[model samples]
Target: MKNIFTIVLLFATLSFYGQDKKISFLDLVGNNIQVPRGCEAQSVYELQACNGTSIKWDYYSTDMLNEVFNATISAFAEGNSSKTEVTFTSFGGQLKGYKFKMGTTFQYFLMGTIKDQPLMINLGTPKDITKSDDLDGFLSLFFDEVG
Candidate 1:
């Protein structure tokens, strides 16, 4: 009976630790975005109000999709003093992100159509992504479009 109780406790602990560590934040446009847990929402007028130690985001919108995206990426790189090249990745379908290093940390500037409207988001993280799978996992949080 003690062994069975121990096994059950172990299983419960593992299950609790394996749970997803994320919280949802709705953008001004009503699109639900999943941010890392512990992000605190700031005051109005800030699209990227949700701020946390591990991750933060800034959201934008533009009428010209490609042109605006290119200019935004270039401006961000220049502003961050990042001389590195920007790497692009398609998050399946119309969703895509431009990964680059800003200062000492890595950032992903995502651009895609949300509800037929053009949307751009810059996801900033403090940790350096060393593995491809880790980067993928981070980017995957923004994969699904929800309201």
Candidate 2:
């Protein structure tokens, strides 16, 4: 009886741990831009590029989606001083970002709404920025949202 109980407990533990531990934010982008270096995954969903760039996927479950989007846009826009690249809204969804020329490298802050979810991606020469992505090709490999 004791042996059977132990086996049951072990099984239960493994079952619990076996649950898929993945959160996705990649549904936020449209397509993937092939970068030269490559990428390193910090977690199943989070990614780091070989070029000192890091990408973060943040998800908020709230009906007040616009509030979150506005807040994020305000935050990124407040600090930009170097230069502005382009700001536009289209099918890829609205995006506003900046690019800075640091010597020979290009630093950028690309933030916007991806699939109506708040999305922010930062990148540079793997030396300045901490986060980074591609849209279509990266989805299957990176963002697999498990219910």
Candidate 3:
């Protein structure tokens, strides 16, 4: 019985460790965002948060981060007017994201260092995709901020 329990616990720990640091679609903006129509996940490039316990924000910079978001927005807007803003949280630190229109459809690019790694969210949009709840949820994952 002890052996069986130990094996089970070990497997559980290994499984959790294997999935240790990954940014899934949910980690992007939590709920209220989904895989939009007319497009599939073209590709995903993930920068792992850490091997052991570590902070996610130390890997990237504000200027480089904003460039990614702004460049995506500009591409979607096709050289039209586009804008982005930087936001910071005491716990989560700095991040950048934006919403824009491409031809007739909407797109979003939300990127930041949350969970102690760089996360870039790029996808088609849902109506009211610009939700404060999404941003708060994204940032709050790092900080112990309430409400």
Root-mean-square deviation of candidate 1 = 12.5
Candidate 3 Cα deviation (angstroms), residue 62: 7.7
Best by lDDT: 1
Ranking by lDDT: 1, 2, 3
Model 2, span 1-147: residue lDDT tens = 999999999999999999975433333355443432355555533566644445555545444444654565466556555565534332355556665656666555555566776654454542332233232234224322211
Q: Among these predicted structures, which one has the highest TM-score?
A: 1
Q: Please provide, for model 3 over 1-147, each residue's C-alpha lDDT reduced to its tens digit, 9 standing for 90 to 100.
A: 999999999999999888845233322323222222322322222222221111222234657766765666667667656444424333343445565555554454556665556655543423323434543322333333212
Q: How far is 122's C-alpha from truth in model 3 (Å)?
A: 0.5
Q: Write the per-residue lDDT of candidate 1 for residues 1-147, one digit (tens) a residue.
A: 999999999999999999974335635345455444555444221224233223333345555666777887788667565444333333332546566675666676667655556666566666454444544543445443311
What is the C-alpha local distance difference test score of each model? 0.52, 0.49, 0.44
Residue 35's lDDT in candidate 1: 46
**Which of candidates 1 and 3 reaches a greater TM-score?**
1
Clashing pairs in 1: none
* Higher-TM-score candidate of 1 and 2: 1
Where does candidate 3 stray beyond 4 Å?
1-70, 82-94, 132-147
